[model samples]
Target: MENKKERYQVALVSEDQKINEDINFFLEDRFHIDVFSNGVVLYNHLTKEPDKYDFILSVSGLTGVHGLPLKETIHKLGFSHIPFFLVVDKADNDMIQICIQNGITDIFIKPLDKITLQTRLDFQLKHPVVGWKKRKQEDKGFNSYKMPFVKRVFDLLVAGTVLLILSPLFLIVALLIKLESKGPVVYYSYRVGTGYNIFKFYKFRSMFTGADAKLHQLKHLNQYSTEKQEPSDLEPERQEVKELCEFCEQAGGGCLRPLYDDNQIVCEKIFNARKKSDKESAFIKIKDDPRVTKVGKFIRNTSIDELPQLWNVIKGDMSLVGNRPLPLYEAEKITTDKYSLRFLGPAGITGLWQVEKRGRGEMSEEERLSLDNDYVKNFSVWFDLKILLRTIPALFQSENV
Candidate 1:
């Protein structure tokens, strides 16, 4: 006696009922298809029963909790074993790059080609993703593209030429820095770069001597610090406030009773928490910081402080165009595989984000990280050249130091 073959389980997420029906009709013979209208429902179902589906096919532009973000969520939740594909009406190069970065298995364009779709689906099903080999190949290719012999020659030539031409300016800046502040003319910090490689990054000193010692005193002025609120009696009815007060009392912690009427119990608490951990903000910046010397302000605003980094490029610690390297503190926070993708390319003096958002102060931290990831995914030699050209104009823009 022969046994019946079991159908492969697939979860389909799309808002359009007709499209869902068509996909079901095509795949039902080989797959036990489950349909979902939005990402939220699909996510909930997957969370409850992660092993229920062997594959996920979602529309790119679903209304509540869109496909790309949901894919990221799934990846973050360690659901990389199941293959995920996106069906899109249209997708640009940037969108495609983002999809690839998020580990999307494949993208199917709408006005669906039934035959091609079936062929692709069948191929992917037969060849399940085995290990990290594919992802490593992609990273290896990106890293190779970023550090070709030609690029190395370009970096050496450009950095050498720039350093030679700017020697007089460097001397003048060093003199100014020495005359104004009692410290070394150049600043060096340990920075993490490609492959999480640690190297000493150079820059002209842009703050006062012993400025680091005063960081604790000026932490309140840190632009990136998570804001904390002093609890008050007005919010006493809130359960969180009550619980905090109870915790404080039991822990023998200080209370904000002095500021409240009738000596009501109140406990200070952090509010509007930062999305990133404190360690991730190792490179803190403050606008109009008091720690900067007179010469420091001028050099930083005009980007003269960045000149010494040409030496770093010459030493092969950085490139002319790539993602900015992070400080060790910040690098430690990106230990996860997905976030670590930013390290697949060489570190740079000026990169995609710096050129794209020049003089734009409203960019969020997540947006900056996304730009770095995008650069790692899409960068080529020509792309690097374009970024370098764009950076020349951006130098005069009013960007942060």
Candidate 2:
């Protein structure tokens, strides 16, 4: 018999009683479990007894606190040493990438296999997640992309010269941005680049202040937003189209996929399948976006807003010619096996996609990913030079992408 003191202590947080009960049933034999109904309560308890658990397992969506935000809070509160695992109903590629980017120690999909859960927990017990470490794609069998020495030297030389000569233009742009908007001159956001590496990406402030906070509200304006199909009045058709996942809805199991919930309790997998069938593009792009200021519009049209990225190139976050680095949300959506090859090459300011399809006004997400993958598979210094030369003429083409 195992001694009570020898068992690992676990904290499980979930609002679903059935889920809590099911997880407890699977884990009770091997670990000591303390359950919390929400993240706030667990956080409060941890404050008083920080060392009470060796690991934390929480549902993605909570009543008082969401999983990703709670993890951010935990890190901010200096609890970065504790292993934190996220529990989701379905483990979609996008969700997995998002969780890993946010430093989740591990993720467990719903209808959790007992043996797999036990094995994972046992391993985590022996080697607890210590400091919050960024997870990379090395273990997934992709070699980390390294910039060639010639490319690196070229980037440094070009970026250095551009910053030197364009220093005056940058100041002028900064003044115009500050005069036009009430925010800082430069905007910076986290971007995922080669090998799934996250870095701070910079650009001159083109959109209005607080543009990011309003992104969700303005998703309807996205050029890539799919038109939803109105349900047919035919009963048989509606019945046939009713989305129900095998393990989630059809099996009468509790809701496992929460990301796609349409306020109707539909599983994420089912909802995503519906969206996929509808041909929704995961990439969001808006033409003539309402968020851009007049100054923003002018700078963006001339590609002057992109100049600050020279600093990023100088810092080795990117190269002069490669696939453009993507925003976090965009990166998450494309992390599936079909599109992940894009990340195995250098991320950059301009590349094959930009030169080939920037002003075409009809580049689909699949085409863009395909172009990026092609670049990754056959990039060389000579090819980079050709791309750089092509970019010079297209630099001032105004598409308002």
Candidate 3:
């Protein structure tokens, strides 16, 4: 007798009863489906147990929410590896491109092909997407760079000495943090490090208790986003002119924008309109972030906020000098082949990127990732010492202010 296949948990969101029924008819046998009427309800359910669902299925345009922003939020919360499939009413090139850019796994147009959909879903289940946990276990021998004995010795010595000497300072900072904020003195979060290893990264708390919850709301203030698109003289004129589609000519105006989908023209004004989220920068770095307390600002500027990471270094989660470990959200964005090289090196408290452009706030995402790769290529005891020396000067300077 053939063994029964495991039923994967799926979260399907749609208000259209017929669509949900149609999808259930095809997938229920192989998957356990939990239906949600809207994205907001699904999102709340997801936050409680982000790893519960094997995958997610949602309509292209949710009842009250747009699909792309929801995907972005899910990725930002460190659940990017979950396969999120979008079902659109019709095939739309612009919607497809946007979905691809945001890392949606697949798209299915209306009147889904049962054979094609089932085959793709089965294939995905058999070969599931790798998350950080699996990557850490499987890639260790092949991808992780073994720390040299001398390097490990140096990290321990330096980290130990600094932490011991700064004990009094740590106490003072902790007191200040407590006095200024209602949160814990130290902020710890899951950060992706060398070889895609996830670890609890610690820092002196520099913001309020719920600062992280406010991150998405404050995305508009990101300094990096401001630089994503340079101002052009013709931008004003471009926004005013609603380009007409020759394929859908009318008296007043044709389609605002025409997008080709499988050789068919789709006049989608709804999808084409400029959205505030589209302006959000891939990298999040806000100048004078409002969430920061007065004590937070002082610690951040003086580099005191990062001092707590010495504990991480001593605990073997990082090194004194290597590529800085990235938060889960930032790390997820750079997992493409071109940028994955950064993970082969050690996670660090201070590194080449910090030394090169610590407070300039001008380094683009590409430049930062390239510098990380560069450090991975040239890292040595001597190279690390040079970077350590450079870090002292960089810490004292803050052109970003």
Ranked by TM-score, top first: 2, 3, 1
Top-down lDDT ranking? 2, 3, 1
lDDT string for model 3 (285-374, tens) is 877788889999888888999998998988999999989887655664454456778888999988999988877757766788889999
Superposed Cα RMSD, model 2: 10.5
Candidate 1 contains a number of clashing pairs equal to 0
Query: Distance from true position, residue 224, model 2, in Å?
Result: 2.5
Q: Please say which candidate is ahead in lDDT: 2 or 3.
A: 2
Which ten contiguous residues of candidate 3 have the minimum total lDDT?
Answer: 232-241
Pairs that collide, model 1: none
Question: Residue 268 CA error for candidate 3 (Å)?
Answer: 14
lDDT per prediction?
0.70, 0.74, 0.73
The true-versus-predicted C-alpha distance at residue 273 of model 1, in Å, is: 12
Give the candidate number with the greatest lDDT.
2
Worst ten-residue run, lDDT, model 2? 131-140
Of the candidates shown, which would achieve the greatest TM-score relative to the real structure?
Answer: 2
The local lDDT score (0 to 100) that residue 335 gets in candidate 3 is 40
Cα lDDT tens digits, model 1, 192-276, are: 7776566889999989888877765665555554452342334233132343455456676554321111123223332113224
